[model samples]
Target: MLVQDAKNLVIERGGVLNCLGPKLGARFDYDADLRPLFPLIKGNLANAQLYDRPERVQFLLDGILCTIYAQEVVAAPFLERDQVLRFIHRLTATLNDLYTRRHSLGRNHRKTTMLPVYDIYRLLPGTNCTACGQPSCLAFAAALSRGRSYPDRCPGFRQPIAHHAVYPVYDQNGNLVSTLEMELAADADELNRQAQPTREHPAVALLTAREEEVLRLLAKGASNPEIAVALAISPHTVKTHVGHLFDKLGVNDRTQAAVWAHTHHYL
Candidate 1:
């Protein structure tokens, strides 16, 4: 199992939730090395959001916010301790399932962005459609931008698919500060407006299917021989793949390649 247990579950500032009627934010520390699963979750789950640097992953499910890190998991707005415990149990099972099926899932390491409220507003039907339970399209747009609502809420909304666009934010030293990610509408006008953001990062060269498999295994600390055996390939072929990975990733050795995979959330 990827995550055997979640320990130290506790409510944080339980009283602040009084107005919200006993809603609780619970956190628990764990021992799982979930870095390798980040890419799998991000690429496979349509609703999940991922970030690097400190490595945080989050998704909204059933109106609950579940945030995961390398060593801990947090879920919020539960009614009681039992609810939190049940959530933790379900989350642990889900993580374990994701890890078990990691080999079959696709991987994506692209940066994510937060869309502006107005941009989100443009994607809606703009009919002042209160069918989504919101008074106005602008109000619904605000909820969508804040991750408090989803695009499917609007019945007249034609395109509900998420389109990811990355815009790198840099500081004066040209060091990357953050990457802005947004779900774009299919409209051409939306794309034109989105093009205004500065994109400093060059397009990343994607890895082939076999190369991705090899990299994932390598990141999991598998030796070359183990990778060869797992992939049913010759040792010489595995060595060649490793060499290619080193060259493509601009890394010197296997350890460096593994580090790169982790940093980029490829693992």
Candidate 2:
């Protein structure tokens, strides 16, 4: 029933819904047909299809795997089949509500307004420091898509001479929508200051004192194997802790986390 509902919903939204063969590896292709409706929608449903598998739902719920893709919810590698169905039911309801509201507003709410980083890189310090908690230049670009952060928090982009620039609009399906005027620097700065630090761990506030010590050791050049020996835990256990640390830190790489720890005096 869940699968059928999902298929129907996808079609109702004008999305192409095809069941992938096993050899395709749980892949689906939500093409440009749904572009205008969900501007953030990107290419191929490769990651989104992972939710169809029963064993990966826990990862989805924990945000360990894909969370939301193309506006569809996905799970990770250990979710049960029944759980996936339930998720679909909940998702469908939420989407229905959203669609109703959007209809009333006479606009597609899934469309996201974005600013390209290249046009504004000149206003940014271009340090790629991850001080804002993102790893690379492109990662920052992606974040800007959400309008959560601004170019000036970069410290380098705070120069007075930098000109403001606007990015082209896109739908959730990664389809081009329209171009918007560049955001004023004044507005951008206000938004940046209001941006909260990305939650590293959803289950806790920052790291615990013990976790901080472990992270400090990691920043100071301790390998997972070495950390395990120092903390008197098995290497596998160290790996688990490290995984948690990465999520808590919202870091994609250990080096970035290390840099953050050093810059913020976590080390």
Task: Give me the displacement of residue 181 in model 1, in angstroms.
Answer: 11
lDDT of 2 at 127: 73
Which candidate comes out best when scored by lDDT? 1
Clash count per candidate? 5, 27
- The 10-residue segment of model 2 with minimum total lDDT is 11-20
- Cα error, residue 28 of model 1, in Å, equals 0.5
Model 1: per-residue Cα lDDT over 55-105, one tens digit each: 677666455667678877766667777887888888778778888888887
lDDT of each: 0.62, 0.44
lDDT of 2 at 256: 52
Clashes of 2: 27
Give candidate 2 regions above 4 Å deviation.
1-66, 69-92, 99-162, 165-185, 188-192, 195-214, 247-249, 260-267
